[model samples]
Target chain A: MIECNNLTFSYRKATPILKEFNLTLENGGIYGLLGKNGAGKSTLLYLMCGLLTPAAGEVLVNGVNVRRRLPSTLRDIFLVPEEFDLPSITLEDYCRINAPFYPDFSMEALKRNLETFEMPEKIHLGYLSMGQKKKAYMCFALACNTPILIMDEPTNGLDITSKVQFRRFLAAQMNENRIILISTHQVHDVELLLDHIVIVDNRQLLLNRKTSEITSRLRFFNTLGAPDTDDPRLLYSARGVGGFANIARREDPLDEETDLNLESLYELCCRNPKLVENIFNPDNTSEHEQLG
Target chain B: MNNLDNFDKFSFSRFMMLAKREIISSKNIFLMELAVVAGLIIIAEFFISWSALPSLNDVKEYPSCYYSDSTCVSIIFVLGIWGFAFLANIAASLVCLKLSNKKGRITTFMTVGTQGEKYLLNFLIYDVFFVLYFFTVWLLVDLVRVIYVDMVYPFEGKWVLFYAIDQWNWMVALGTIALFLFSQAFYTLVSAFSPKLAFLKAFGLSYAVGFLLIPYSFFCSVVLIDKSFSGESNVIVIMASSVMIIYAIAMQLLAYYRYKETDII
Candidate 1:
């Protein structure tokens, strides 16, 4: 299990990035960390990876402090950053050096993953293209088989075919021993794979819910005309091709058949910051519990 | 299981891998070594040639062949060039140390087995390579001198040749050891910090030290060389060189011990 208790982090003293953040993630589930460009998504990921030091509170992975950088702790966690430079060496040579770090590392699996990603085995890492290098690193990380894997925009540079292949690979690879957290702006690509959705805005966790519960409770309905503007739960009303009334089902629904489009829900959540904060506040755990 | 700490499993090979990476990836180091070696050879040749120029008082004397001058020039040239091998070894140690620093101690601590021990071992290995290279250069120079000179100077005093070889050999050996030991300390200091900034930091500090100490210490030895050639043996100069070497080794070990307990950033 990964736990963050009252985690307050900032690059500088005054500019607070993450404030009094508390989050818990169990093993096996795929978590999608969604936020805007400067909403601290990457910073949160880096904090979890132990890449950046936390100002207050602690990030404990299976009772081990990440700050210590213990080998066992590191062996259990793998952070795939968006921008990383692999050392200039052949795939074989790179594997020979890094593979031994993780006890569960499988050379055979790494080789197979490389083939799956359509990366050549013999070429030096420096010779590989940017997309290919990312794939190679991803392949190696997957084969490392760490229990906690944090990937920052894993699908950023992937081609159409590779992206599809990557999704399939991820689905096939995921297991109960692993907890994967992916931070990305491309929600559609990861929406199907993620078991849970987490949104960050206004320096706090605005929403954190299981996909099944969220989809069931929140109905995203389209209307030809604008609904009563005074409705307290009317989170957002986007004027689409028809009219305004892009409603988020925060309270009891009028009818049962309507389904919530996650993209539309995300859009609604971002537009009105107060509604999201009010709905998912720590004080109202009972509401979230009811959804569970 | 009892023998192994958590780090032991990964630390050994990771450091070795990084060391190999450092050596192979850096071409600038080799170029620097070559440049220094070549420069030393040229400088030594110039000085030897200048010293051999005949004075006005020896105008009527039997013309001595410039063969002795050539021998002296060649010996000094070889010695100067060979000195760079030791300096190059120092360069390798510094590079490895710097690279380790930039990568961060976490990399060494988590991935490599025995971070401290592996650091020391890799540095020593780098030092050994340069030391052996210096020895090889010396042997090659000796071979060329013996083979090329015998045909020209048909019969010369073997004692003179032996004396010249003995005097130069100690200087070469001492120079090699002194630099190697100095590099060990430098590597520790650099590795204690991160390799990325470590080079600049090490260079900056060393340069500072050189500016402060070189004029007084380095020049003092140069002055002693002249005095020794007069009537005095210059025992103080020999003692100072010996003391400098011992101090270098002690300083390196002290740095290594300090690094062992300190928190790595």
Candidate 2:
């Protein structure tokens, strides 16, 4: 489990990346961290990994402050960065050198993953293609078997076949002991697998809710005729092929079930931040039920 | 594998892994350079020994000892030592620059460990390794030349190895220390500004510092031009190198503090 309280970070004195950010993540589910470019998703990931200490807030992982960076504290977190340097050695040599770092590092698991991807064993990692390198890194991250895994844009450069392979790998590897956080602009790629959604934007956490609750309480629909304009419960709207419509409260007489598009959900949540804020607020328990 | 292990615990181990990975991967290129230096030392020893011998028949005033009438051996030795320092510094600086920019510019600080610690450790280890390789190769070449000269016509007063060590060891030691110190300071300042500009800036800054130091060295030489100034000048150089080491440590600490406070990633 990861808990962040009032986290604030700034690159410069005046330009803050995260502001009073608070989040709670439970174990055993994939979380889709959604944001536009420069929305601080990667910053939050770094904080969790103790790569960047929070300026004011505290990030606790399994009850220990991450900034303390104690050996015990680091064993549980792994971050596969969007950009990383692959060591110049062969894959085998790289594994040998790193295996000692993680006490639980599994050579068997790492080799299995490589076999799954059909990566050559003896070749220097520096010579591998970009996708192959990413595969090697991903395999290493998982082979470390940390409880908290953070991936920033893991799917950005993958081909179609690699994407499927990646998804299958994650699905097979995930367990109740693990908490996987994936931050990507490719929401559709992970929508079917994510159990929770966390949206960050405008220096705040706009929403954090279970995917099931989002699908249950709100119904996403398209409209052709007069759209419902005066409904206070309507969260966000965008122009469709016919007219403007949105994710609105499921009213029996007027609302109907349509497929929930995560891309649309991300767009709507970002467009009407205040409405989404109000809906996900813990204080608005009664309002949360109104959607149900 | 217990899932609850702390991730930061892995930083040092990971850092070593990364460093070793880089070293092994580049070993071929590094070895090639090392071979070139080794070959140069042997060739230099042969030529300098030929001119140093008292045998008038073997004396040469051309490439072997252009300053054969003066202190040709010492001058050649000093120049060789300076070349060694430059090579070591460049190698050390380039590695740190590469590591600093490992993840794109903004993301470098996001690597698993303390940036300053990793940077210093990497530079120190590589510099030490290179210096050892340099001295060992030079020692062997000098030893061979001394044995050859002793076989042909023995010198009256000097043991070649001891003379070489007495004259060259201090410079090599000081030069290693200087290279390590300057590499850290230069790379730290460059990396602090921007990764894209780090290597270029470091190169320019180090060169400028070297250029500035030339006049400084000349000034010191002029002050100590007396025949009895050898011991005093050597001590001063050692002290200056010590200061450089401390400066490197200070700069490394500053870079760490900067990283601890900044939120570039």
Q: Who wins the lDDT comparison?
A: 2
lDDT per residue (tens digit) for residues A161-184 in model 1 = 898878877877799878999999
lDDT of residue A158 for candidate 1: 88
Q: In model 1, which regions exceed 4 Å deviation?
A: A12-14, A221-234, A239-247, A250-265, A271-274, A277-292, B1-125, B128-265
Give the alpha carbon lDDT tens digit for every residue of B35-114 in model 2. 88887777877677655664655544322423333344454445455656556545544543543443643334433444
DockQ of every candidate structure: 0.21, 0.28
User: Lowest summed-lDDT stretch of 10 residues in model 1 chain B?
Assistant: B224-233
| Poorest 10 consecutive residues by lDDT, candidate 2 chain A | A283-292
Residue A106 local lDDT, model 1 = 87
The TM-score measured for candidate 2 stands at 0.76
